[model samples]
Target chain A: MTPIDEDPPPPSPAESLRMIAEQREAAERQLSPDPLVYHGPWGVAWLVGFGVMFLRHGPGGTVLVAMPAWLPLAVLFTLLIGAAIVSGVLAGRTSRHVRGRSSVQGAMYGFSWFVSFAGMGLTLQRFDDGLSPPNVGLLWATVAVGLTGALHMAGGAVWQDRLLFGLGVWLTLVNVVGTALGPGWHSLVISLAGGAVMLLLGLVLRRRPAGRPNE
Target chain B: MSELDPVIHAQARLRVVAALSALPEGDQLAFPRLQEILGMTAGNLSVHLRKLEDAGYVEVTKTFSGRTPTTLVCLSRRGRLAFEEYTAAVRALLPPPST
Candidate 1:
């Protein structure tokens, strides 16, 4: 233990350099973002929202549940909006105290999410009267999920996280296959492949030690 | 010979400066957080931080968080330049790389 006033004897030249490197690395690790914080909320949102949608219908236009079709859509949108809000506020806190390149990048990425979703929502609404219920449903589901997958891929590339990029690719492929399979199955694929996989990843990876110790 | 800045040459203060320098310009860390990282007692860290503050090498801000008192520390602009100079001086002590 070092006394308050006593300094350690002068370190050797190599030792001094090593010490500096060690301290910088430790501090950076402690300050890095947490994966769980990023993944958990979205995982839950997709899983529950899509899972409900899957249960509301069955194969070959059979109605499995008596509830209105709007119920599942409402649940999915509500959960998705909730997930977006929670993630934004929590993630924003990390960059709140500092202003620099990383901070600017975070802000811009967040704005992109807002802008892309808003634009998609507006374009879809323009077709409200023209498109039939089934066609519009297909459009909304495919467009939203597709945009999410594309954005995830973009984010993964920007952050250089291979797992995230892979997940985006996985989501995109499953989304396409699910759309082709049709009639209640699209939601099934999304719930299981997209939502469940994310939840599993988010939960399992959460157990891995975070770079920073909790304060 | 390039001389080390005496204010930063001390091991504890050198470590504190090194850790703080990792933060981006104008960013700050709370006192408890710094102490936790360094594994130092509050008294030891406060003394070293005080010395760095006196030398115009670090900025220390004391304020209340809700009801509790909090100390926030950041390396000043002078401190960053001093650390850069110090690292360069330390490098000067080493022999040049062989081809």
Candidate 2:
């Protein structure tokens, strides 16, 4: 058993400061949470959701799967909703132990997500009546993914995480290319290029131990 | 010369205070989680924590998370002020930087 009664000599002033700095960094790491937890759910959601879409409407609008028309939309909505709920719960769980400016920032960020997505949903529904099926799919794909990328970049800026900001930019560029490819191919591109990137990054990050260089 | 807190002057308690102080105001950590962060054995941690609790520098709460009991620890407002003072005192001990 380690001796509790015995006391070590006090560290020098500089050494004492160093210890404090180290412990503070360690505590910050614990408080902030793992990035992998945030990324993994979104990755799976996009991969499965878009993968199904790609199968239902193959590249260049060629019908690959013979499933009922409603099945694709149903599956996609279910997965996206599930992922959103999980991400919200994870964020809440991690922040429940702490409070201050960061908590307020997180809450505002979450609200922004709701507001932006709600607006997108309303606008998409309004336009759904006017557009053809393929065009409708293209509209939803570009706008939703584009907004998601912009919001993600905003979040990254708020947190000052360069990697996350880069990922957001990558998502935007991926969608741009997917948009150029048109409807059916867009899903395939997003599933592989955007969603798969998140999953791969999550895997890589989880394997490495968390640390910050001394500052 | 007596600016340093005798209670916080001890190395183990100093570390405990420092770690707890890092938490945002009103934030807490599970006992096991704190022990893991500090790399201290359970018994040793309990001993130091008792000292801190006795000094009124930390609050230890016994609560149930589902069926299991959890001990949550947080630095009190008094403890935070004390840490700030302790830090100032430590800095005061060092000689001024040469031009």
lDDT of 2 by residue, A109-209 (tens): 99999999999988788888898888898899899999989988998887777777888999999999999988888999999998889888888877765
Model 1 Cα lDDT, one tens digit per residue, A1-215: 23235686346767778888888877765665556667777887788887787777655656777789789889988988888887887767665444445566668878898999999988998887897665667678888889888988887776666677888899999989989987478878888888888888877766765433211
Q: Give the distance in Å from residue A214's predicted Cα in candidate 2 to where it truly belongs.
A: 12
- Candidate 1 scores a C-alpha RMSD against the true structure in Å of 6.2
Task: Count backbone clashes in candidate 2.
Answer: 0
Top candidate (DockQ): 1
TM-score of 2: 0.70
lDDT of model 2 at residue A102? 64
Q: lDDT at A78 for candidate 2?
A: 92
Model 1's DockQ? Answer: 0.28
Per-residue lDDT of candidate 2, residues B1-99 (tens digit): 764677777777888888887676655788887887788999999998998888888999888778988888888888888889888988888889999
Model-by-model DockQ, in order: 0.28, 0.26
Clashing pairs in 1: none
